[model samples]
Target: MAKLFLLLFTLLNSSFLFSQENTLGNEYCQIQLISTEKSPSVNPPIKNLDKEQVTLLEIPAGKSRLRLNCRLDEQGVFTFGNDEILDVSWEALEVKLVPLAASSPSFLLPTGTFSIDFVFLTHHNYKQNFVWEPIVTFLNASLLNNITMGVFYGLCLTLILYVFFMGRVVGDTRFQFYSLYVFCAATFFLLQEGQLNIFLQQQSFLLSHQFYLLFAGFTVFTAIVFIVRLTDLNTTWPKLTRYGLEFGAVVVLLMSVLMLFLNHNELSALLGSAMARVTLLLMLGILTLVSIQAYRNVQSAKLVLLSLVLMVIAMVFRTVLHDVNPFLQRYSLIIAFAVEAFMLAVAVSERIKSIQTDKILAESQANTDALCNVLNRRGWDKKVNEILSEQKIKGGVICLLYIDLDNFKQINDKWGHDTGDKVLKVVSDIIRNQLRSIDSIGRVGGDEFVALGIFYDRTEAENLVIRIQKRLQAVSLHIDKQKTVEVSASVGHVIYEEPPKGAEVMLSQADQSMYQIKRASKQG
Candidate 1:
């Protein structure tokens, strides 16, 4: 009976040694046993094994399983260790942590000191000799870390969705895919880091892992898509790297399922990490190459090159560090997202600007007469109404002038239309040279022209019309050798202080006065 009590005491003591109030509270000796192997000690040599409290159990050589774990403290001291009894072979080690306390609603385990042996795996042959210890687990993170990651997740998702939705209307495929890729990368990091578990009532085994894998795959795919698009790689490199990315995507998709179901997590993780690094490098390198080519290849790609430079710098800092402070991580994604989104926005804006410019150019061309470079008759009529509408409310005088060239068709009949065209051009240039920038001129008849000007006074308006007629009369044209013709114009004008009697009324008043003067000149 006494011996039995002693054995019980021993059992309690052993349990006490392994258990603690909190792993975090006992920071000095916090150890996580991730994996173990029961095999021959001399199979594959292990490195960085601390020689204390580590037990070895053996089964055979080169057949041991690897167990891995991470230990952390408030001081930010983090260390990873494995408890495979034998040396590790080249057989890869994969560790998948469920962290039930993080995902389970009723996850209250204990509030006091305790310890539990976390056994990852054992040799298939050594199952009978030793029982695997249950895992030690806890869920403790600084509120700041949790909140930082949470905010980042929300912000990134928002920006991504905004871009995609905007892109739908804007018809920019590059923005659409870029947003998708950024969303995938942001969400995957959140899930993998266990930052998004707060929202889930209960974590679905398949959903958690599978969704993570899906996002990771999509992130890689979208990155490749962006590279191909940004570089126009099909026309540029167009070689093995392009084909390899396509093939890699397929392989990654298939293996992601297998990795989840078959518990080939190590293989999956290693490949995933490797693929991530490779994708980042390839994308950045391709972008750099494209930027160099852009300098010489196209002048418009300068912005594209600048944007790529920013992305390359951001990615290099992101991937190299094993762990980043939560605040920095959150900040990094925000800044990077802003930069990328801004770049895309600029590209979209440039396209919109170009379209608007083209419309303006077309409208200008449509309003102009090709031969005289004056407003077309229809354009002048339209503009007159627009100006009158404004002047009606604002209270201003609009001056209209009618001018007829004397014997102009006789010159066309005698000198040929080519020279007649030259004379017309010369006359149009003279009229344009005499008017204020505010005045508008139009050719309203075969050899007649009309001028419209807005003025605050009738005196300035009359002076402008007289100056124009005098300028035209002084014009001299050489019709042929020793046959130079002196040209003169009959001018008539009217000013409307209020709304016009009618557009046709004002026009006819000016026209009839000009014809009367021409008739008087011919009779004289």
Candidate 2:
């Protein structure tokens, strides 16, 4: 706990990041777990209010309804049935809550504790809503809450669509998981807003708040999978860590299924202490992984970890860490979710760049020569053709050189293949070093090499050929402490002002020129 606080303190001081959705009671509203049982209260007490139990008249047996002992500090009217529970969820009210109904009923009672059974709506008015109906899940407290929720929902939706389409364009499933998480996260928060009851008041699943919880389970699942995929955690994590995560996932799935059958209290237990602890541990575990990856300088991890930490902190303070400021509780998730969306977008962009980089590297490796570290025949031909095409467009000439090492086989026989191999390496280095970096070279055959370069004209082309020949002739190989052999090459050159049919024809002419040079050397 100390370490967590220390880390959070340091990070919070330095940077800011992402957000998510939730329930505790969920985020935007608290569903009053209304019950008719003559049993012990299942509701955790809202802070700053005294507790005293009162029984209502209407019941199957001597069953009683739980009445909250409360008083409002500031005078204000509270509505029922339309958007009420959330804004006042943090505010301890001073009125006895009873099962009654009216079209967005308002409570404008004077402040007092443990006194009056405030008349909310007439008993005759509750006739249609006495059984099997969601009494009041939402309350409209203020427009600020409304605006806050609107902004939160909008940000979540925008990020969701952005990441989803990016995944499609890039053809990477990692982005898809992230996008799903964004949506799950947003929808989970929406569940807490009690808007679901507005649309599905008749549906038991929504009224029971099980559907809200089901999405909570989904949020956990998606968050887990998203991190796993993003960090490649399965491969990177130790076996025990991996198993723990897997186990957590199974727990979430089981819990989700349980939400379907459990009553409000049972579901609350499922989402309450035990589940919150499990979720906290899961979040900490993921944070640990992101930390390790960030340590290794994994860029995506670094980018996401910054934002993810804020979200975890917001969730912890909102859920498990009690007695916090009401203001922090209200806006923490909002800030966290918005910033998290931004970071996720940043992380997704980095992933796309990484994919592109890997692809280009793969293509380069496919076309490269293993021994020479330059282009092989296939790569050389393609590059030379591109250069030639550019030269044709720009109205310039290109030089092609066909170089054949003189008496290369004789040198191999006298000096052994080891020296011959060394000679080949040195020869390739010499030719490559003498040419422009953009020029193309390839080992065409045994002791045969080719090169192509852009030139101002035939004069510049011929001059470069002379320089290459001189550089090659200046080489000497030492076979022993006292023994040496000379290295030389016969060069054939072609300068093309007009575009050739292809690289093959240019190479053929250069080869013919080289053979002529060899024949002349023999006569001389």
Candidate 3:
């Protein structure tokens, strides 16, 4: 949070640098090559420096290039390079551009020439290797870049953590791939900015370009996988897109891994770069094609298509059109990443919501009896167990009503199966109507049903049973033009003041009570 505020504060103070005259924010020191000895790479072989900055690929093994007279605003200027001398007469310094890699490895080496033949030059070139840019100018130029990098990394990290937290709630599949994708992308961009130095003993990730390619490829691979899962591409375009997407992701990933292991000499490095670029192009083509097709039918995919297009534009600014606009080149990828991460995060939440909804509907369907319009045995046990498990309801009176039709098989035999089904439906409706809304009913058998309820006492429980029985007895459900059958049940209930462990014990006691009622009725 503090870092985020710092970034904002830096942006707000952008005009401060230009107002300071002592800063020399836009000025370059005047330099002149006075001596005629000049390296071939140096443009003007002699005299005054003009027209643009100088960059050297290499300086000859041991030969000195030239003598330079650099004039500052009386503060003076000097080159950060190898062992050289300054002639005070003309303020002239020898120009010998020996980069660190080309210098001696010995720490004991004398900076002075081996004119003292008794001693070996064994020490590193400890001289400073800094460019001639004012500190304020560097900060001013890099202000936007610093802000962009901070926000980009900050947003990516926050989203990753958010997704992981959600993963714990919903499940790992919801956020794992998406978070990994973001992580790899963040790493790739960090490498691109060349900010991650000092790893592998001062070798910047910029030097190991393979890691750059590696992470870049991984970002694409995980992104494709995330999209495939998010849009449910397999179930929809199984054969059409499945092979193409998987193949592309796998090939790109494989090539990226391969680049890391290869011995990258000049030719190898060239080939590896070419391979990485080609794989990227191939994967992007595949991604674009798949996303466009998915967008037409899948509503969720519209966001995905937009993210991909925006990402492509960001990449163009970061790479191909970098010289077109400095702002776009520096911050375009960061903007793209921020937008893409947000869109993906939303997509993931939607997926979680959809999964939960589907699960609920599936459970409902599985535990319901269509014919009776009531809970099936599974759902009955579930509801009863829930009621019994609650200490509050169990402390009062929980009545488990076991209902069995007296002549259900007889009705089926005499009036045909349709009449029997209608009778059961009618009986379920009558029982439901008699009981309170909090009560639950289920069809446990062909003609056996169970219901659960809470009441004030035994009197209230008996009153409910009486109402159900009376309603069932009074039902004159017509079977056909020839006859009508009375919809009735033998209802036996067991009231639990202190609920038992589970549902089955209460059900067994109620079933026994019902059998006794049925036996006495048969005798009468």
Better of 1 and 2 by lDDT: 2
lDDT of 3 at 58: 23
Q: How well does candidate 1 match the true structure, expressed as C-alpha RMSD?
A: 11.2
101 Cα displacement, candidate 1 (Å): 11
In angstroms, the error of model 3 at 492 is 0.8
Could you tell me how far off, in angstroms, the CA of residue 315 lies in candidate 2 after the best superposition? 2.1
Candidate 2 positional error at 296, Å: 6.6
Local error of candidate 2 at residue 28 (angstroms)? 25
- RMSD each, Å: 11.2, 14.8, 12.0
lDDT of 1 at 228: 58
Question: Which digits, one per residue and each the tens of the lDDT, describe model 2 over residues 1-524?
Answer: 99999999888765532221221112111123233344435453322221111111222222223233333332323333321111112123434444222223334433433322222211111111111111122233334566677788888888888888888887988888888888887887776654444455433455344566677788888888877777777777757455887578658756766757754453445354465578778888888888898899876888779888889888766544524554565457768878887887888888888888898898888777766666777787788779877986887788999999999999889888878877777788889998987777888777888888887778888888999978875578665456587898998888888888888888899999999998998899
Query: Which tens-of-lDDT digit does each residue in 445-480 have in candidate 1?
Result: 777888888888788888888898789766787644
lDDT to native, each model: 0.58, 0.65, 0.63
Model 3 lDDT tens row, 1-524: 99999998887676565565455432333332222222433454423322122222122222223343333332211222222111111211332322122111111111222111111111111121122333343344346555667788899999998887787777757478889999999988776664453133334434455677788779878887777777767667677556777667777787778767764344444545565566667557556665765657674677777777787899788657755764686578778878988998887877677767887988988899989879998898888877866646446678888899988888899888988888888788877887788889999998999988877677887788777766655467775566788655677878777766668888999999889878877797
